[model samples]
Target chain A: MKEFELIRKYFSERGPKRKDVVLGVGDDAALTRVPQDKLLVVATDTMVENTHFFPDASPRSIGHRCLAVNLSDFAAMGAEPAWASVAITLPTSDEKWVEEFSNGLFEVAEYFNVQIIGGDTTQGPLTVTVCLKGFVPENKALIRSGAKSGDWIYVTGSLGDSALTVASKLNKINVKAEHLEQAQRKFNYPVARLAAGQVLRHAATSAIDISDGLIQDLSHILNASNVSAEIDVANLPISQAVLDSLDEDSAIEMALIGGEDYELLFTVPEEQKGYLEQNATAMGVPFTCIGQVRGGDSGICLVKSGQKYPLPNLNGYQHFSSEEN
Target chain B: MKEFELIRKYFSERGPKRKDVVLGVGDDAALTRVPQDKLLVVATDTMVENTHFFPDASPRSIGHRCLAVNLSDFAAMGAEPAWASVAITLPTSDEKWVEEFSNGLFEVAEYFNVQIIGGDTTQGPLTVTVCLKGFVPENKALIRSGAKSGDWIYVTGSLGDSALTVASKLNKINVKAEHLEQAQRKFNYPVARLAAGQVLRHAATSAIDISDGLIQDLSHILNASNVSAEIDVANLPISQAVLDSLDEDSAIEMALIGGEDYELLFTVPEEQKGYLEQNATAMGVPFTCIGQVRGGDSGICLVKSGQKYPLPNLNGYQHFSSEEN
Candidate 1:
């Protein structure tokens, strides 16, 4: 079978039925009606082999991660994800790989209440691109330009474990079996903090998803909002699994500079801090106040103990880094 | 710099200013407010290296083709394209490639009056995925399933030239240089029939863009509309350039099975055919009647010398054909 026929036969099976979708795949274009009271929030993310994932990574994990990362984008914007279009390119049309990949993708999508509305499948080196279409009330989305001076910065969940898992997988680092599994799962199935984001809309002045390391990703909000931040090094959230596998210093470094955590990071005004703490407690999710937004300087700073120290030069994952070569 | 920083520095430049674009790139997700009175149409297409284009094709052409194909999908639906998001994956972050690609993408976007709303960039083998969001009046859009028996099938411009261009390029066939240039241009930069599609909304009963060759793509309408078609083989609009490059039989075959023409193939009611022809002529484009829809075996057939015959087994372009190996 040719590529189009293969797609029509195998990949063009019935997607999740939804009232929002007027038309699905196999047509010239998909048609969906957005509710009148909602604004559409759109985000796209692409993952490549060897750079975003190991060549040996299962197709199921790749598919899951592809949708997961796009969902993270929706989470950052405080949007309720509704529909997604996926474009998959492969070195060849390996039926086994495509079957597993689609299964994994649909599995994750089902949990998030998202449906595969449309997509394209083609031949090329393995790549997955997902464009998520979500909805939020008009003028209620969290943006990266709203942070103000005196707001408290918060991060949901722990960070840096995903980066450590990458290193362990690549450098063959030995660690406790339980720690390894937790790290691997964190790397593969990082949850998007959609509930926290939606809840924080009224409180968060600015928000961003932690795809890059905390320091680098937080810099995006600072640059966009024209504010500086002072993070308490002692308050950085490091998971027990990561802390057990690596020394305290290493865990701190990873927590500060590791990327791909997919956690929600935001700044809430001082008046809203109480509301946030209560909400986090009700949800049973950790929301640590790790930093404070400040005027002037316009960058991130780390305060260790009573002394302020300049951070080391550590750029997060560049696509063409010499270290990778 | 990391992939995120590079994207912010280069690809995050402002897009065309549009009132509909509530938020653009540089944010976690782009928020757009669709006009309350209009319906949104979404389409996505992915182009892969060596599959969608020549290995040596410039990044500019790749970007242009990527957006153009998605726009063609919008054209088929008679939708007014408003915004697009592009997800690009590259093996390495070459600054020159990014510059050219963005330039080519925005050039077409400007021509079509669409805004580059948002997208993602990552490290991977070269692949470009574009998702377009367009709008039309509620329940006033054209679709493939609206064709009825007795509708006259029509196509815009000529066909079969793109396939010939591909063959010529691959085999290094030395035909007339002008003919080859015309053919190659049609293959690379075929225009989507946006104007024709929009104007024909009232006249066209069913429509589709000819990306998968005329016979095969038209089969989609037949299958969806539950009708058969009788196409006069002699009436196919074959350009002189394409005719000169091959014998009459081969030219007919090319027109029937050649893909990537990107022209509009549509059906009009008998009463509206005259209006369509007059409108097309006023627009300075050719609209040729090639067939008539009928209720029969629900398949396409060809009429040669007043005798009906089943078309040959020349399927349209399939991406995963074993013959490629």
Candidate 2:
């Protein structure tokens, strides 16, 4: 099929229909109406073949993962995802692959009420770039720079499962057969904590999504807020699947430095802690208090059983680095 | 260098800064404010190595072209280009290349008053996708579906320059040295008819930017508006450089079917012709009337000296087709 037909059949005809979209796929540009008195939030993310996913990865997972990563960013900011523009570059035009890929993409879009407004499909190595546009009420956005001293830091859901899956795939670790399925599911279909972010926006002082592991993403909040944090190593939320697959130390390391965790990491001031506790059920995920924000320069201190825990040698994922996936 | 550092050095610290941007670059997502009573217009375009440009093409031109294509879409919509989110995938972090590439990107951004609000830098084969967001007054956007029968078809500036350059490079045509330099310049730097689009908004019933040749893009307008068109082959605004190098037949062919023109093709109704003519100088480029819209099923006819002009066998570019760049 031609590029125009492929796009029309796969993308333009498939995604969630939105009322605010004045014009959608078949135009020079997509025209949308921003709700009155709402601030517009924008996020862009790219997933490349080899670096971000295996060449043999499922098309559905690839499509889901690309949009999920960008949604994760919006979740951190307490924004409501409204529309997306996807640009996909592929080596070949496989009809089945495009069908399954659009299915996965539209599944997520429908669930999140996001409209696939416009997109561009081209010929090249496999790469997917999603640019998401959303909205937030004025002064209600959760920013990385808003954490305050004495705030209790919390993370949504368990960690290390996705990282453990990746480690196992790389042969750096081994997983038991019983836990492999759950771990693979965690890695392939990360659920963005959008509901939790919206709930946290009312109480959390600041928030960030865990894409580059706990430590690295937390460091962004710390650096932006000019504060430090002390995380209790024993209190880390390591999933049962991850714990069953590796030793305690290895699991902790993966939880700390292993990337692709699409969970939310947030901080709550002392006054809002009770409010968060009361409304925690509305967050739509299991919550855990892992640490406390400290005054002073940016850094993270790990505490294990009353003593300072030594930092591990593992590094968070970074694109263009020698150790990239 | 790390992905974050590279992005900070090349993209975050550069580009035009606008007052509407509440947050930019560093955070997981960007926050921006939309002016009251304005609607948001979005356009996305991607350029990949080998498919869109040669591997040895200058990074500067690649950067400029990637953003310019998107800007051209906004120009066609008669929208004011404001913010852009760029997603770039690269094989390696060549600092010099990045510096020059950002230079070209920022050069266009600054000239057009567009803010580089956020971006993603990933590792892969070179690909750049730009999603641009701008604003158009409510109900003021020039849409392809608005054309009416008897509307005069017009195009901004000259055509066939870029395609002629590509043809010469592919050894499909020969050009004199005098014309070669001018053709290369036209191919490298396409000036999106932004001012013309905005000026034509009041006068034009419909508009589209010619990317995949004049015929293919005009067909889009015809299909959308449920109209047909009749082009006067002798009246096409072919550039002197193109005519100087090729025979009249070949030059007309190039003008009709050559892609990557980036010029605006629009329709002005009989009632608006006086308005368009009065405001022509303010459009920032010369325009020529070459055809007229007709009431019928979608199709295009060509005429020369009141006789039918034969349609050529040449096809416009399409991804995944056998005849691709």
**Which CAPRI level is candidate 1?**
medium
Fnat (0 to 1) per candidate: 0.63, 0.65
Model 2: what is its DockQ?
0.55
The TM-scores, one per candidate, come to 0.95, 0.97
Per-residue accuracy of model 1 over B1-31 as CA lDDT, tens digit each? 4665666666566447788888887788898
Candidate 1, after superposition: displacement of residue B307 in Å? Answer: 2.8
Report the error of model 1 at residue B161, Å.
2.0
The candidate scoring highest on TM-score is 2
lDDT of 1 by residue, A1-325 (tens): 4565666654566446678777777678877888998888899888888878989998889888999988888888888998888888887778788778887787888888787877888777888888889799988999999999999999999987788898788774556888889888989877778888888887799888888778877887898899999999888888877788888777788888788888888999999988887787543467889989999855888887867856756743433421100
